[model samples]
Target: MERKTNLIIAFLLLICFGLPRNLGAQKEDSIFYKSYTTTNMEPWKKTMEKMAEELEPGNYKQLFEVTLAWYGYIGYCLGNDKEREARQYLKSGWQFLEQLEEMPEAGAAPHALKSGFYGFEMALARYKAVIFGPKSLSALKEAAAIDSSNVHYLVEKGNQMYYTPSVFGGDKETALRHYEKAVKTMEAGGKYQQKHWFYLNTLVTLGHTFEAAGYLKQAREVYHKIQNLEPDFKWFNEEVWPDFVKKYGYE
Candidate 1:
């Protein structure tokens, strides 16, 4: 009778603490995303590797998601002067991505990640730009064709257009259009879904474009929207928003 009473108390405690059945899995995903959004690349990379290890070999959905996170983390590293570490991530990333490609359900997801990886590789060695650049472009095109409505693929295409040199056909206007399309698609998925890392990234990138173009009003609005979605987002709450207000004045 005492053992039964104790078991009941323990179950009540779990419920009272709000520990949902999937709390462990949710915690892992949340930590990795937080690391990414805060620009903590090294920790994000490590978290992603840890996640990859936790997932079973045949679990393609988790594999695809973790691999995508790892790809983004590597790109962040490459851009932030962490080339030595990024190189190691890139090598491991490629191996994981290659495995992801074999999953029939992965569709164009693997291609999109591969395109980003190639672009980063080109950034590291300009001499290889001639080879890797076109490959990246071609891979993105294939990914888009296969999954035209995919927000992730659209965001990547937007990134490529935004960053490519104007002489080489970069078009900010076109990039903005792709980004807007992605935003609309994500929005249609409902507000709750927008809190995901991918959706937040699309909105953040759009906000940056607005700020860079000197559209302060638009940028401010985007930042406010982000705050509404995630009030405690440290980077925005502590850094980007404060700096923007400092530069432009909070009217």
Candidate 2:
């Protein structure tokens, strides 16, 4: 009876002490997948904050995930009309990106993200465009040059072309080509072995590009491909597709 009682005490102590370490491990390793699978950024905000808190100060992998999460969080805030909150995330995201400067392969993503943030700032204030627009383009160019095959870099480049004015050398057809290259990069490299938000978002962007350029049939076909790829994506199924069909007169 005494032996049984001691074993029970030991087991309880292990549970008390071991769980935190286990949970920390999960937070560290699983954050990428967790962030990827969760489309809604509100809840992911808390999850990412917790993940960041659990990260060791100089762990580049965790830092990269946290930075990426901040990017998404900032976008979410901006989309929800929470500009103040978005600015806060943007500040942190910049700091995190700065921390990654030593590793160019990893730093390329941060540069790409910074480029997007600069674009966002320009959108918020027209005066910023004169200062930030060139900076945004430069950053993305650097990112792409650093890693020509990176899908993220290609996607950002495509985005820059898509949004720039025609007088500034923006061409929708060129943007479509960049996006296609990004998709091809992923496919050729098997980068989508795991469910990746970037890969999925790239596909969505392709569909949007088609729609924006008045390629109704191409856009509809892309949407069908998206449905086949991710039948469980609720927003795509219930909202984006339905609304897109109506807006584009796809019937």
Q: Report the lDDT tens digits of candidate 2 across residue range 172-200.
A: 88889889898877877653432566677
Tell me each candidate's TM-score.
Answer: 0.82, 0.79
Worst 10 residues of 1 by lDDT: 190-199
Worst 10 residues of 2 by lDDT: 28-37
- How accurate locally is residue 87 in candidate 2, as Cα lDDT from 0 to 100? 79
Kindly list the per-residue Cα lDDT of model 1 for residues 1-251, writing each as its tens digit: 99999999999998877585257556656776677567565566667777877887688877876787777777677767889988887888888888888887878768878888898788788799889989989889889889977776778788888888899999877777788788988898742166567777778888877787677788888988998988777777777888888988886
Score residue 16 of candidate 2 by CA lDDT. Answer: 93
TM-score of 2: 0.79
lDDT of 1: 0.78
